[model samples]
Target: MKVLLHVSHLVQWDIALSNSKNLKAIEAKSKIEIVVNAHAIQLYRELSENLLQQLNELENLNIKVKLCRNALRNNNIEESTLPATVEIVPAGIFEIIKKQEEGYYYVSP
Candidate 1:
């Protein structure tokens, strides 16, 4: 199954990443995609090196983390700050709707 995780709340990236880990544990073979919008990117940028390392592990698990272009612009975050695999989608909400419409389960955390 395809799962779309919408992360909009502000907090440590570890929490979001941890949730992703838990989800993966529950559904070992599920295809998980994450959308980090608004303040979430800001939190990720501020994470400590160790936390960032944990986030890097997500890539090994094949979980794609996307940042909202609108949110990046609104927060004045440079593209260079993001990880290489972090995709920039046009609109996070639209992506969520589109994925849900296409049969991906929507989860917010």
Candidate 2:
């Protein structure tokens, strides 16, 4: 099964990650997508190395991490500043909608 985790709020970062981890742990073949947008993009950038390591661990576990281009523009953040693991999409909401149409279950914290 696949899930699209829509994360728009900075406060939900930890909850989203933890739930993704739990899902990945319980379902070995589960597909996880983490979409970070809005204030969460800045939150992602401001994260410490340790938290980033946790994110890396999720990537290692095959979770796809996405960032929104519009969110970056809104926050005045450069696209080049994002991590190597994150793929920049045109917009977070659009991506989420596409994923939903593609049969990916949506989860939000």
Candidate 3:
């Protein structure tokens, strides 16, 4: 199973973290992708050091993280400035659509 997590607000960080726990607990083969856009881009900036470390660890667990280029542009952040774990996509909405079409289950978490 594949899951696409849509993150667009700061409040969703908790949702994402909880979802990560659930996903990791599963025994079945599954893929988790977390996409960040809009105000959620700042979510990373606000993360506590421990949480940030945990987020980086998600990559090791095979949970992918993505950030929208347009969102970064709006915030005046350079794509190159993002952490190595997060992928920079052209657009968040488009990426969501593409993932959906590819059979990923979409979740706001």
Candidate 4:
């Protein structure tokens, strides 16, 4: 199973991360990708220790992290400051649509 998690607001990070963790725990074979856009892009920079640990856990689980290039520019977040595992996409909405077309279950948390 492929899951695409869409996180647009800063406040949704916790729930999104929690859901990703739960999904992996429930099915280790599940493919998970977390996409960040809008205000959520800010969280990708200068992450708190707690959030950094959570992201490391996601990496350990083999989950992919993607950030929107548009969002990064709009939020003034540098790509270099993000986690090495994160992929920067051209656009978040387009990426989400493409993932769905490829049969990835979309979850907005």
Root-mean-square deviation of every model: 2.0, 1.3, 1.7, 1.2
Candidates in order, TM-scores: namely 0.85, 0.92, 0.89, 0.92
Best by lDDT: 4
lDDT of the structure predicted as candidate 2: 0.86
User: Tens digits of per-residue lDDT for model 4 on 1-109?
Assistant: 9999999999888898889888888998999898989998888767688877887888999988889999999988888887776789999999999999999999999
Clashing residue pairs, backbone N/CA/C < 3 A, model 1: none
Please give, for residues 8-109, the per-residue lDDT of candidate 3 as tens digits: 997996788678768878843688888899998876554468766866778777888888888888887866655777788999999999999999999996
Backbone clashes in model 3, listed as residue pairs: none
lDDT of each: 0.80, 0.86, 0.83, 0.89
How far out, in Å, is residue 77 in model 1? 0.3
RMSD of 1: 2.0
What TM value does model 4 have?
0.92
Best-to-worst order by lDDT is 4, 2, 3, 1
Sort order, TM-score high to low: 4, 2, 3, 1
Error of model 4, residue 16, in angstroms: 1.1
lDDT of 1 by residue, 4-106 (tens): 8888877635566877788889888988888888777676555568656765788888898888888988888887777676788998888889889989988
Supply every candidate's count of residue pairs whose N, Cα or C atoms clash at under 3 angstroms: 0, 0, 0, 0
